[model samples]
Target chain A: MQENILTLRDIVVEFDGERILDKINLSIRDNEFVTLLGPSGCGKTTTLRIIAGFVEPNAGEVLFEGQKINGVPPHMRQVNTVFQRYALFPHLDVFENVAFGLRIKKTPKDELNRRVMEMLELVDLKGFEKRSVQSLSGGQQQRVAIARAVVGKPRMLLLDEPLAALDLKLRKEMQLELKNIQQSLGITFVFVTHDQEEALSMSDTVVVMQDGVIQQIGTPEDIYNEPANAFVADFIGDSNILDGIMKRDFLVSFEGQECACLDRDFAPNERVDVVIRPEDVDIVPTQLGIFTGTVESSLFKGVHYEIVVDVSGYKWYIHTTDNVEIGAQVGLKFGPEDLHIMHKMFDGTTNVLQGEVVGEDEIEFLGVRFTRENLGLPVGAPVRLTFSPYDIIVAPEEDRDATVYVESVIYKGRFSELIVWKDETQLILRTQRDEQVATDIGVDFNFDHIKIEPLGEKADA
Target chain B: MKSKVPAYPYFGWMAVFTIIPMLFVLYFAFIGDDGQFTLDGFRRLADPYMIAIFLKSLWLALLTTIICLLIAYPMAYILSRMKLNTQRTMMLLVMLPMWMNFLLRIYAWMMLLENNGLINKLLGFIGLGPFQLIGTTGAILAGMAYNFLPFMVLPIYSVMTKIDGSLIEASQDLGCNFFGVLRRILLPLSFPGVITGITMVFVPAASTFVISQRLGGGELMIGDVIEMYFVGAEPNFNTGASISLVLMLVILIGMGIMNLFDKDEMEGMLI
Candidate 1:
């Protein structure tokens, strides 16, 4: 394995009291292409700036070749950046722009000319050196910016969405060209982009970030095949995420059917988030599959048909070359290897459920009634109820508002966490005493803890 | 045809206010006082006294323009980098003096520059002599620079603010220090604004008679000579028109030289 050329330790950056990077730690290997991938406002650009020394993190240290360079200026750092807009000097010609760094270093005339001409040829701009930057096309300017940054022969190159301003065909062409250049030069390239396909195609390692936190880091194949969490699974590609109960080793149950999986090391009957790629599912006859559902919509998306099936109330996206008609009954089938189970991100504290107002002060959900003051909602109006786990009271008696079956009880540091089911709805709560799995229990809600919000356009007035 | 309609009123106003007056100047420049066409007025401009006055006006204007440029470029660069709200507030302060009457502002400067004025009083308190200040060439130059400083600053600030900030970062990324960035990027990019500022300040400073009269205490300039010939105690419209024609030619020649630096930008400014 190659050695790590750059490392970021607990890097934190804040702007106007808003944390843009939260304790981000990463390592880039020598001659590696690492991509920071996320949507806009996800701090990918800020992370690039931190490495380039254009932005100083509020805390933590940036290590380059085992040296701490916290306050080193950008000019002194052995790293160069190609800005987002290809910020070529408007007043300088292409040759002069590429020669700027060399001229600053006071290189001899013959050597400077030879090196500049070589760089221009590398970017395929052989005879265009004398043209002013303002007169060049966007892709040509992008080439000039690349040539200029790399002409200095820095240890690493940082590209901030260098192809973002080009057209689709041009961007595709540049993406391949950039990858080729990085390989030929043998320089570490740290790229930042919001385009998932671009990141997946160009990088040796993909670091997925969201909301100032690094979600996962692995090779492109590892990140795509074995995502760390639900966010990573959903962000990397089209996926169907569903709530499931891990019955035991190699067995899970969801959508009223039991299926085998490859995940283990969970408490028996534990709640887990199940991810299935759209391309992994195969449509089968209704009576010969694990589950059946009505097709909600089918879109012919180029290479495959994107079919959305309504399994109970949840929509499962399936990509298959076989075309399925909308509103037709269909059965989905997938092997055990296709199922990826992950620990749920939340601690199951907050429960969001859809309900209807039965009266001015009464709401109905999971066949249970709750009363409040000043609901102001008319009868039969749709609403949503959100309550915390602490609001649920589990008791041994069967006289409560709803009867539930205790599915699991796992030991938490402060208390035991319980997952109970009332009909088709799952409720998670904390209890002081251990509860036996598969035992009958009664549950009630604390009316004061539930927050009600009206649903749909009917409440707009 | 429709777009040209709005310009007709402006053309009519120019004919009445500008073109006709210039035609009168041209007519009187070549004609004698007896209304016969002659070169007597042009011949009088060769007098050594009038030539000296012209030279003095040119020298004072050049000095004032140089001083204004030196002070305004840095001020404009700093102001452009300030926060948007602070930039607005600072620009308002820079423009505030123009709101008061021009003559009133010059008189205020006179009171501060006189022998026993506020400035000399402070110098006296600091154990310095009350030197001669008000009736010297320095006073006239000071007044001209003070009045035209905002003109120099406004254009440069407007230009500098439009510069993309990433260009500066790119320079640094390519190993440019602070002074290197300023010299290679900021200076070249702000050239159009500097040219505009020079033209604005120099043209007005070269033609003003009031500052020399109030502050120079009898130091005569070309403007004062033109005034004496046209509207002063001894009025001679012919001689005044010829001097005005000559001054206009000199200023045009200077601007033509300046325009050679950046022709495209100059054309943009002209239209």
Candidate 2:
């Protein structure tokens, strides 16, 4: 087994009272290509910055080769980063830019020239060393950035969306080139990008993040085949996620049909999320299928036909090479191994608070009045309000209605679950932003997300 | 092309306001007072007193440019790093004095530098002398630097702000400490702005007569001599024109030398 080259423990970063990274724990192995994959503002770049020593985590230890390097500056660390925009020195030629690190280390003249020439050759720009970086094309500039970063021969290289600025064909070429370079150099690479395809194709391990929290970390194959949650299943590729109940071990029920699955260890009759990849579903004769549905739309997606089927008012997307007519009765067939069962991210049983209807479309909870629609209950009527923990928005103190004191914060894979209290009432909420324990903050509800049920109706159910 | 039509009026304006005036200066420079061609106007420049005055002007202007640059580079760097709103407010404060009349601003500086003015009064509180600050070379130099500081700052600040911040981070990532980044990246990249700032400050300081007249109390710089020959009791437009032509050539040559340091960047800016 390869030794761990870098380890980030409980890393937390906050900017302007907003948490940008929350308790991120990641370990990168030596000579491994790890990609931090997420959309914009997902803190993937921030994680790369922390590893490159450009950002100081608020609360965490950065262990490089098992030695704590939290306060070490970027220049002192044996890590280099290729900036998102390439950040090639505009004043320097290609040769000088690649020689920057070596010159800074005061390498001897002969070796410096040899190393710079080798790096330029590795980047496939042997004769173009004397060319000004400004005059080069975007793809060429990206190559220079990579060469300049790796020429220092740092233990680890951090690339921040370096290929994002390139054209599609060029980006694809660079992806393979980068993977090749990593293998040849045997240097650990921590790359950050929002391109899912790039991450899947290039990285040995993919760390999927959403809103500053690492949703899942696994090998690319594991991340795609056995996603940890609905978010990962949806983010990794096209999939149909539906609510299902785990009837028993290796068996789940969805759409009023029971189907055998590969998942186990769930309580009987427990609610779960079922994920089926669009490409995994097989179209077959109606009598041979586990379930039948009417094809609503069929699109020619080059290599395959993308068919959307209406399975009891729920759309099931399926991709197949076989063409099926629109509005045709089709049978959906998928193996038990294709059905990925995951524990539901949110359970409706929790985050239910009792409130009184104060006005039309208004309900009062925890001494704060919020405007909610379709209350239907008269004034002074009691109601039970249920909302997803993700809907609880934490606001700054000056912008809040009811002040809540944070009691505890648990770092879920996707968000921070907080147990906060106001007066005598305690509430559980989930947010991407990290809040300090024992601190007072303002709380607000996304009114659109609140589900109101009359008190008497809840008793009957 | 129709696109070229819009530039025609500018060409006309250049001819009337710039080209023709330059021609007139050249014409007058070669003409004698008797309306005949003579080398006497150029010969008069060889006098020791005139040469001394010209050299003094050059030296003072060089000192002023160096002083302004020393003060402005760091100031621009700090300003560039400030928050956008704070940077705007600070820039406004830097430019606030320029909104007033130019002569009025110089007069204000004179008041401050006078022996009994606010500066000396403040110095008196610390038991320092009511020093003779006005009517000295120091006063003239101070006035020139003060008046031209914004010119030195504006270009450098604009350039520094336009510098992609990631370059600094990239440099640091490549094992560059703060000073290394500055020396290798910031200084070389901002060279064009420095050259521009030098041009803007030096040209004005070399030819400025008002600051010396107000602060130096009758000291004769080359600008004062040119002013005397043009509009004094003994007005000599020929000599004045010749001096003006010489000054323009000297400035052009100085700029040409500055361009050698950053030929590509200068061309980039021009294009």
Leading candidate by DockQ: 2
The lowest-lDDT stretch of 10 consecutive residues in candidate 1 chain A is: A407-416
For candidate 2, what is the DockQ?
A: 0.45
TM-score of chain B of each: 0.94, 0.95
Q: What lDDT score belongs to each candidate, Candidate 1 first?
A: 0.88, 0.88
Q: Runs in model 2 with CA error above 4 Å?
A: A349-461, B1-5, B36-44, B264-271
Deviation in Å, model 2, residue B34 alpha carbon: 3.4
Give me the runs in candidate 1 sitting further than 4 Å from their true place.
A247-249, A267-270, A349-461, B1-5, B38-44, B121-132, B264-271
CAPRI quality level assigned to candidate 2 from its DockQ score: acceptable
TM-score of 2: 0.85
In model 2, what lDDT does residue A97 have? 92
What tier of docking accuracy does candidate 1 attain?
A: acceptable
> Residues A1-461, candidate 2, lDDT per residue (tens digit)?
99999999999999997778989999999999999997677789999999888889999999999999989999999999988899988777889999999999999999999999999999999999878888899999999999999998999999999998999999999999999999999999999988888999999999999767899999999999999987688778788887789999999998789999988999889988888999999989899987898998999989999898887767788999999888888888999999999987655436887999888988898888888665566787789888877777899858777788775554433455677777777677878896775477887778787888888644233
Cα error, residue A323 of model 2, in Å, equals 2.5
